[model samples]
Target: MPETPPMTPPMTPPMTPPWTPFALFGALAVLAWGAAALDAALAGGRWPGIVTGPLRGAARELVRQRRRTVMPDVPLVRAGVCALPAAAVLAAVVLPLGERPVADLSVGVVWFNAMEVCVWWALWLTGWGVNSLHPLIGGYRFVAQGLAYELPHMFALITAALGAGSLRVSEIAAAQRGLWFAVWMPVAFAVYLVSAVAMAFWGPMDRPVGSDIAGGVRAELSGPDRLVFEAGRYLLLAVAAAAAVPLFLGGGVGPALPPWLWTALKTVAVLAVLVWARHRLPGVRMDRFTRVSWLVLIPVSLLQLLVVGVVVL
Candidate 1:
C-alpha cells in the first residue's frame, strides 16, 4: 500500500468533433463565393458587382432549363459534374483553416496533388460524355495542358517538400518560422503559382474553356447542372489559391492579425491576382505552351529544386 502509485489517466488521441467537416465545408464555400464575386467585380470594373453579380447569375442558373444533348451518357455526365466540387472540397481538407487543418493527414501534400488529378478525370468524363465535338476538343486541350504543367508543378512541390524535409503541409508552413520559402525559393514559388492557375484552368490558362470553343466543357450544361459546374470551378480556383499559402507563403504567418485572418487575407490576395490575370494576360495555345513547359519550365524547376536542396543541406 505504501508503494502504490497514483493511477494516471490513459493517454488517448483526441477525438475530432463531428462538426469539423461542416466547418471546413462552410469555410470552403465562403472562399469560393468570394472568388466568384472578385472575378465578377474585376470583369465588370465595379466593386458592387462583386456582391450582386455572382448571386444574380447563380439564381438565374438555378431556374434555367438543363439542355440535353443527343444520346448523352447521363451517368458519366452526372459523375463528372458532381466530382468536380467534390475534388475541390477534398483538396481543401488539407489546407489549414487557421492553425490546424480539418484532416491534418501526414501526407497532406500528396493528398492535395492527388485530389487535383481528379480534375483531369472529371474534365474528360464531362467532355466525352456529352458526345459533342467542342467539348471533346476542350477535354483534349485540358489533357494536353495537364501533361505540360504537371511535371514542373510536381517538381515545384517536391522542392518545397524537400526544403522542409516533410510532406505534411503544416510542417512545411512551420518550417518558415523566419524566412518564407517564397523568398528563398522564388523560382519554385513562381512555378507553383503558374501551375496553380493552370490546375484551376483560370486566367491565362483557360484555353480549355475558351470562348472560341463556346464555353468548352461547360458549353452544354445549363440549369442546376451548370450552376454546380461553375461553382465547382470557382471552388477549385479558391482551393488552389488557399493551398499556395501553406506551400509557398508562410501559411497563417503575419504581424498583427490572427492566424486565421492572415490566412484569409493571403488567400484573397492570391485569388485577386489570379482573377486579374484573366483580364491582363493573353491566352496561349496549348502546343506552344507545351514546348515551353517541357524545355524551359522543367529545367528551371529542376534547377530550383537543386538550389533548394543545397540550401537545406
Candidate 2:
C-alpha cells in the first residue's frame, strides 16, 4: 500500500471578497482629482474651475508638444515616467480595503517598503535620463532626501509590525481594535506621516521639485509625458496616505459605517492633510532636513520601535 499522506486541513473559501484590481485604478483617479482640485482651491481657483481643472490640464497636455532634450535616454525616461504610479499601485497591494488586501501577502509591510524604494529609482532615472543640469540636481536631491527619511520610515513600519507582532497589514489593523497605535505610538505615527511626505516629495518635503529648480526633475517633460508624470506624483501621495490607515488609524474599526468606508474616510483625511500641507507649509531645505532626519527623526523612530518591542514582550 502507498504510504499515507500527511494530514492536512481542508481548504476553505475566503470569507471576505476583495475589490477588483480595477478598483485600485479607480482609487488612483479619485486621489489624483482630489489632490489637483484641492491644490487649485488653495491657489485661489473657484469651484467649477477647481473641479474641472485637472481634466482641463490633462486635455491641454494631450494636445501640447512633447519636449525633448539633446542626448536624452528615451528608455530611461520612459521607465522613470512610468515608475511613480506603478510603485504606488504595487505598494498598495498589501493594504487592505476592508480587512483584506488585494495581495494579502505574509510580509505586507516589507512588500510596501520594497515598492516605495522603487520610487527613488524611478525619480533618479527620470532626472538622469533627461541629461540636463537642473534635472540632474533634482535627482540627486531626491537621493539625499531618501537617505534622510528611509531609515526613519523603515523604523516606523517596523514599530507598527512589532506592536501588532505581525507583518500582515490586516493583522496590524486587527491588533489595533482595542486602541489605535497612533495613541501610544504617536512618535512613530508622526514620523511615519512626515516620512510619507518625504517619500512622495509632497509639500514641505518637496525640495526635489521645488520652484528654485523650475520643476526640477520634470522641467523638460511636456505633453502626455508630463500628464503621466503628474498623475504618478499624486498616486504616490495617495498610497502614502492610504497606508497610514492600516499602519496607525485603526484600519476599519469605526462603529457607524463598514470597514471599507472607514478605511476610505481615514485615507481621504490623511490625503487631505498631505495635500493641504503643500500650501500650508513652506518646503524644507534639504540641508536642514538631512540634519533633522538623522539627529531627530531616526532617534525618535528607534525609540518608538523599542517601546513597541517592549509592549509586545
Candidate 3:
C-alpha cells in the first residue's frame, strides 16, 4: 500500500474575553444602594423606613438648591466630588469578577494602589475648593490621615503580592484557591481592613467629615451636588469592601453557588461591617488615630510583609 500523508493537528481558537463589564455596572449600582441603606440602618434601622431613607435623601437633595461659599472654586469642587466614585470604579476594574477582571492588567495590584492614592487628591480639592475655614481644616485633616494610613496600606498590599508571586488580581485570586491569603497573612488582612475604612474616611477615620467641623470637607455641598458626593463616598466604601474578597477572602471560590454570586455575597458582608462600624465604634480623633496608624499599624504591616516575603522565598 502507498504511504499516506501524516495528519496535522488543528489550530485552537483564542479565548473570547469579557472585555466590557456591562453587567458589573449593575452589580456595582446595587452595592452602592445597599451600602447607602446599610449606613441609614446603622444610623437607625427603622423597618421599612431604612429602605426608603436613601431614596428620600436623594430626592430632598435633588430639589434643594446648591450651597455656595465665598470665593468657591466650582470646577474644582465638581471635579473633586466626582473623583471619589471615579477612583473607586477604576480601582475595582482591576479586581476579578469570577476569576477574570474587566481589564486584567498584569500589574493590577499596582493599578489599584495608584487609583486609591487619588483619593488623597480628591478630598484635598473638595476641602480647599470651598474656600471656607472649616473646609480648609477638613482638607488638612484628611491629608494628615492619608499620611498615617497610606504607608501601612502599601505594605499590606505588597505582602499579598509577595505571597501570590504575581501582581495580577486574578492570579492572586487563583493562588488563594487552595488557601485564602487571610488564613496565613492575618496581620496584612487586619491592616487592610483598617486602611480600607481609613482611606474611605469611614467609621473611626471620618474626622475629615466629623461633627466638630460641621460636616467638614462636605460642609459647603448641597442639593444634587451633595447627593452625588454622598453617593461617591458610599461607592468608595462598597468598592473597598468588595476588593477584600479578591485580595484575601478566596474571592468567588465558594462551592455550590455561582462564582459571581459568591463574590457578591462576600462583598455585601464586608460592606455591612464597614458601614456598621460607624455605629459600633466611636469616631477616633485624628490626633490619637494618626499616632496609632503610624506607630502601630505601620510596624505591624511591615512585619507582615517581611514574613510573607520570607515564606515566598
Choose the strongest candidate by lDDT: 2
Scored by lDDT, model 3 comes in at: 0.86
Q: What TM-score would candidate 3 get against the native?
A: 0.92
| Better candidate number, 2 or 3, judged by TM-score | 2
Off by over 4 Å in 2: 1-19
Q: Give lDDT tens digits, candidate 3, residues 200-276.
A: 89988899989899999999889987888888888788889989999999889999998888988999999888888
Q: Where does candidate 1 have its weakest 10-residue lDDT segment?
A: 8-17
Task: Put down candidate 2 lDDT per residue, 1-313, tens digits, no spaces.
Answer: 4599776543332444545577767876898789889889998999899999999999999999989799999999899989988998899888888778777777899999999989998889999999998888888999999988999999999999999999989999999999999998999999999998999999998878878999899889899989989999988999999999999999999998999889989999999988888888988999987898999999989988887888889
Q: List the residue pairs that clash in candidate 1.
A: none
Q: Which stretches of candidate 3 lie over 4 Å from their true place?
A: 1-20
Model 1 C-alpha lDDT per residue in residues 1-313, reported as the tens digit of each score: 6698787644332345677788778877888888778777767747777777778989999999889899999899889889999999999988877677887777889999999989988888888898888888888899889888999989998998998999888889888879889999999999999987898888889988889999899888889888888989999999998998988899998898898888889988988888888889999888988899999999999999999999889
Query: Candidates' lDDT values, in order?
Result: 0.87, 0.90, 0.86
- Pairs of residues clashing in candidate 3: none
Candidate 3, residue 42: CA error in Å?
2.4
TM-scores of all candidate predictions against the true structure: 0.93, 0.94, 0.92
Estimate the TM-score for candidate 2: 0.94
